[model samples]
Target: MEQVFFNEAAQDLKTIHDLLRWSVTCFSAANLWYGHGTDNAWDEAVQLVFPALYLPIDSQRDMCSGRLTYSERKRVIKLIQRRINERIPVSYLTNKSWFCGQEFYVDKRVVIPRSPIGELISQEFAGLISDKPQKILDMCTGSGCIAISCSLVFPESKIDAVDISEDALAITKKNICRHGVKKNVTPILSDLFSNMPHKHYDLIIANPPYVNVKDLKSLPHEYLHEPRLGLITGDNSLTLVLRILGSLKDYLAFHGIFICEVGNSMSDLITQFPDIPFTWIEFDQGGDGVFMMTKEQIIDMINLYPIFNV
Candidate 1:
């Protein structure tokens, strides 16, 4: 197909489509909104752009091929332009994202699912945590991805999904049903262990909003589309992580472990708690600051190592 160009006199949909197809290949659909442009050297290549990565044209919906006619290309280009003008994430443009080999519906209601928790589940933290867990607690379980993944890997284990926002919980519930894991995964609306802890958890996993003030202040345009409440926390974002870790002991069963992903603040946490042992979990995925500690670990740290308490 020949490349097309935009015309101001009268909109030429065909010409616009050709230009967009040419333009899209030179740069990523996500990168198209950014500051730079790319040279048209690479071959026209396209892959599964996520279920949520919607094509910009209605004419191309049923067709899976990347080839877009002139008019079709123009429609998609217009959509991208609109989103760029509005500063919306292209993920939201498609309404889907892939996490742990599963396609999940995502919107501005919650943050996109990106965490080491998925990798940890694949490793079966159930087996790695020293004590085998029969019950799991997924705190701040947005979209229920963590809880749903946990329930699948640990069939015999029961999971409690806790979140503060009701709308987020609704999305999570839908995912749980989508995967048919409702029997083992329970959704509860609690502001961090408020409704639970009368019961004990064998393992507690959390991927809270630990992005510090600096990151939050200047997050990428794509991230701006997510609910800010789920990203920015405190001046350092350590306050919520600390409060959550401090509260874990009360709900954890004896020898139970707690895993929390604090993003880039793991070093900061280590400096803050020099005495308490933080078994930071290593990961291949691009996630850091996932620290693990058992109830016993916290008990000793609180009683004997008060200097380490943040």
Candidate 2:
């Protein structure tokens, strides 16, 4: 269908609300997927429009009447075109995404931060954690949102953010500085725990690429904009996850807790190691497939699963 207001010779859209409504209509008509950060057309429109106008996302209703300058209108239209035509995620277009209620710089170099692990961090691990962690590790710390958010919650904890992709680490470094948690969060270029220093973490968290090959192929166009290395695992979707589990015992403190977000791979993971018990975490806000385990539990299961090489 031809977009009415987004076409040439169109001049009716003028106010912020007008453009937002038009964008929502355009997005819905285009059948755009909204899994990256939003779940519907209206929220996606606000994500695109509010940042484009340099206004707060929760701005007052009166601000919607403010008129957009010609340049601003052109810029908004261009962004909308990119969203509908190119299928780029809004965060990549705006170079930002919010996680755990804090904003972080983002781009195609890294996956957008939308992990449910943020929920765990916001609650500071609550009942799962017995004591304050002095050291933490965020494996596959894309954009460093997990590590940065941890720093905010545990100000005294030292965080090591590790990623194999140098480009992703570069983005993580930028976010670490952006959040002003430089001293506490350290970015490391490591594939899992290979290059990480010999140190034990009281808590280790990962939001690794757990999408199986099949699922990766069927992801929406918006997800295609992200780095595939940050999403696609091997056929079983446990390639990286198993590797992490293999080395977890060596890096986790005796009482340390491990949290990993495996997305839809939870069922496959359970099937692979049915003898081992994993605490499937549920978020009140919404999100699933994340599991938590204690170091002692992993040690006990290591012998039962050959993946741990016990």
Candidate 3:
């Protein structure tokens, strides 16, 4: 293979600033889609370059002009090539992802943690849930990101991180240990609520698989790297989500809050049960299709839409 020169002026990219600039140009030219923790080429480049160089992501102020060793240049270049040629997400390449301001180990075994529920967790689910939850449930917990984040926010609360995929649960357990929440956050192998212990949770949050058949087919290459089980909900995209709704009331305690992310399937969900008054959360950092409903509302929904009465 021929050497790809990101900069025509220099035979080799030397400084951190040089590599950062070059990566942005290559990423922009590749027309790569960003969404796995970053939204633009510049941010994506910074994520790739800084981590590859063993520097802080926020260290651009002091290290932008710092020179890179020959070996360091090679590592950064190789990661850049993979980012462009293979279209792998930077998080997967680095085996790291950040959620709610904390880092977690990640790879192809689990989907990268990018849920907006982090914002709500940081806010202690304020104005939505009247009190700090004593028991929290994270359904479809891919990397245990939500469950672990909840553990940090609610140190006194116990959390159950449930996922159907054993492979995903392995990653979840690793993250659990990584964050040292073994006492509070417990990983469970369950298909929704099918295997869940008969316990009521004060807060239940899920970033479930909501990609329908149509969107799944057209997803970018970056998404292809994530586990299919974590992304595709069903043919109509509501299969898993509907199942969650059906059993959630059984496990959700009185005055509890239920939050789930359907992404672009929000319209389909609304159409399926038009009468249910779902409270859609508005994230200031930019994400949509996450709906919240109290336990009372969920019971009301079950009454109105008997199809969910399973």
Residue pairs clashing, model 1: 4-18, 4-19, 17-74, 52-94, 52-96, 54-94
lDDT of 2 at 187: 96
Among these predicted structures, which one has the highest TM-score? 2
Candidate 3: global Cα-lDDT? 0.88
Could you tell me the C-alpha RMSD of candidate 3 in Å? 1.7
lDDT tens per residue, model 2, 1-310: 3455466513667889888888888899999999988999999998888888788788938689998887888888888988998999899888879999999999999999999889888998998998999999999998999999999999999999999999999999999988999999999998888898999999999888988878877888788888888988868688998889888989999989999999888998898888888999989989999999998888888877676784
lDDT of 3 by residue, 1-310 (tens): 1354632313477799988898888889889999899999999999888988777788998999998877788888888888888899999888888899998989999999998888998888888888889999999999999999999999999999999999999999999998999999999998888889999999999888988778978989799999989988667798988888888878999878899998889998999888888999999888989999988898888888868765
Sort order, TM-score high to low:
2, 3, 1
Q: Model 1: runs farther than 4 Å from truth?
A: 1-75, 130-132, 304-310
Local accuracy of candidate 1 as per-residue lDDT tens digits, 55-157: 4333343544444455555555544454445655544655655567676767778777878678888778744576557999999888888888888888889
Q: What ranges in model 2 sit over 4 Å off? A: 1-5, 8-10, 60-62
lDDT of each: 0.68, 0.89, 0.88
What TM-score would candidate 2 get against the native?
0.96
Q: Look at candidate 2 and give me any clashing residue pairs.
A: none
